[model samples]
Target: MDFRFGDEDETFRAQARAWLADRLADDPAPDPRAWERALGRAGWIGLGWPGTDGRGYGNRCATLAQQVVWAEEYARCAAPARLGHIGENLLAPTLIAYGTEEQRRRFLPPVARGEELWCQGYSEPDAGSDLAGVRTAAVADGTGGYAVTGQKIWTSLARDADWCFVLARTEPGSTRHRGLSFLLVAMDQPGRIEVRPIRQMTGTSEFNEVFLDGARAAEVVGGEGNGWAVAMGLLALERGVSTLAQQIGFAAELEKVVSAAVASGAVGDPVVRAGLVRQWAELTTMRRHALRTLGATGDPGAPSVAKLLWGGWHRRLGELAVQVAGAAGAVGPGPWSPERPYELDEAQRLFLFSRADTIYGGSDEIQRNIIAERVLGLPREPG
Candidate 1:
């Protein structure tokens, strides 16, 4: 596959780079939620929309690759990756494809412009990987919308989100994965939603446990009983393309750490140098696989490989970064120390956090099961 960007592509990249540099200087970087909206207003929120009516960004393979490049460049520039869940990846695409005209007009612009921040309400406390088991009920209110009641766990940025794409059971007697519906709910409503922070050991509350009590929602996506399909579509977006972008960007960060380690003379030993070199090679291979899978097809099952590979390599990279950082990495600021300059202590935090990489987005074991059953043509295990 020809990965080289053409002259026009190169020109677009140059323009994007310059535009980002200028806008970033004046923009105040906030938490992930606020940064997304700021990006929306600055015309950087939706890199794939390809029309004047909130779709003019050319949503194609080339556009996807360009997005990868932009993601890498953003990380390289140390910019907080803006364009959070709803606007860029999950909801936007789903809405574009399945939403009605009213739904499209209502959601697309805000999402594209980053005026609205969003989160996913899929996994309940009991329904983690088995998303089809969503117990959140959405009974019709007779006046068009539905009243939702349920709890969702592991909601990323739920506390700060203005909107949420929720999966709820609309028909009580229907089997799991059937009779469910996709609804877009406003989080600002009273008595409908509550967000309890699940603080990580890193002392950051990036994910939250969201409780939905009689939350009012509109059927914003695929028709009733088609929620499972819509959810699957959303999962594909999350796992395949978005995961690759995230992993590639992360690899870039790891490279920066490696560079710092080598420059600081921390890799004087042959073993350490060899380990670093091996990791670099592994990262290179990982990037290739990630990009390929991202561009191959929008298949939800394919992302498990990228997620597993990324989780493994990221954990290793984090471990190596902390190992090379040594005492400097473990400790807080000392005047002008290496750790102090770039907040190297964050490396330790990242190392600790990376431990959960395999657990999130679908565990390594789950990914392996998919590979064996789907890719390897293996027999299913006895239930």
Candidate 2:
């Protein structure tokens, strides 16, 4: 497949570069609210949404590609990916697909503009990859809404979030994946919810434990008993397009390491240089596959491949940064410097976290099973 963008795309890229040069230079780090407002004003935030159909830029393949280009450029510049991305990337699309007109009107624009931050209240300590097994219950309160009560662990950014797109059991007697419902709950009210920080190896509290105690809830985006479908749809975005963006970001970091190695003569050692080259090739190849998946608008399962590949690659890149730096690398003051405790600390953290990459999205074993049965037509294992 030809991987080239045509002249129109090229022009768009140049325009994007100029925009970043002007806006990004003034603020190296993104202010979530400001950035969202900027994108919303430019009508660039939700490119995939069906366009206004008002002769304005209608939602189309071209719009999505433009956004992808923007994401890639942002990653290239080492910008921080949104911690509230779960709402923007996964939930918002699901809402557009299944939400009532009123629901869509209420949620989408603010999310697009970053006026509100969101988190996923999907994984309880009890139910993770086995999402169908979620035990968070939502019983009708008789007055109107449901009363939700359960604890959700690893709810990323819940501590600073405004709302949470959550999954809870609505029909206690229904079979797995059959009786669940999705709910959007507020994070500000008391007597219903609690947020506690969960510190990671990175020494940052990017995630939190969310406890729901009699929180008010609405029906799933569409209605009850349809949560399973809504969730599966969200997963498609989570595992597929989300991972594509991540691969782009990781590849950018890989390039920075190569540049540092060359400048320091660390590439002088033939073996070290060869290893770096091999790593770069692998990362680049993975990026191409990711981009192709985005272009084709392929299945959500496509993300499994990207995750499996990059999870390992990110860890390797970090380790190599340490190795290439050598004793001096350990010396303080750079991504490679071991002496800089935080640098070394972060490298170590990423290495440990990478081990969970396959498992988190689904699991390496599970992805292989999907390929074998669904993609490869293998015999299914008996229950």
Best by lDDT: 1
Please, what is the TM-score per model?
Answer: 0.86, 0.85
Candidate 2 lDDT over 60-87, as tens digits, reads 3345566667666666666555654776
Candidate 1 weakest ten by summed lDDT: 52-61
Q: How well is each residue in 1-383 modelled by candidate 1, as lDDT tens digits?
A: 44656677677678767866876788646566567655666666667654536545423323766776666566656677553655568888787667776777777677776677788888888888767778999999987899999999999878768889999999988768789899989999877788999967675778899888888896648887788888877766775455545655676667777787788788886766887888778778877776666656645456777777788888887788887887777775545655335233667877888888878777788788877887788998665
Clashing pairs in 1: 40-113, 49-57, 50-55, 50-56, 50-57, 50-58, 51-55, 51-56
Per-candidate clash tally: 8, 4
What TM-score should be assigned to candidate 1?
0.86
When superposed on Cα atoms, how far off is each prediction in RMSD? 4.3, 3.9
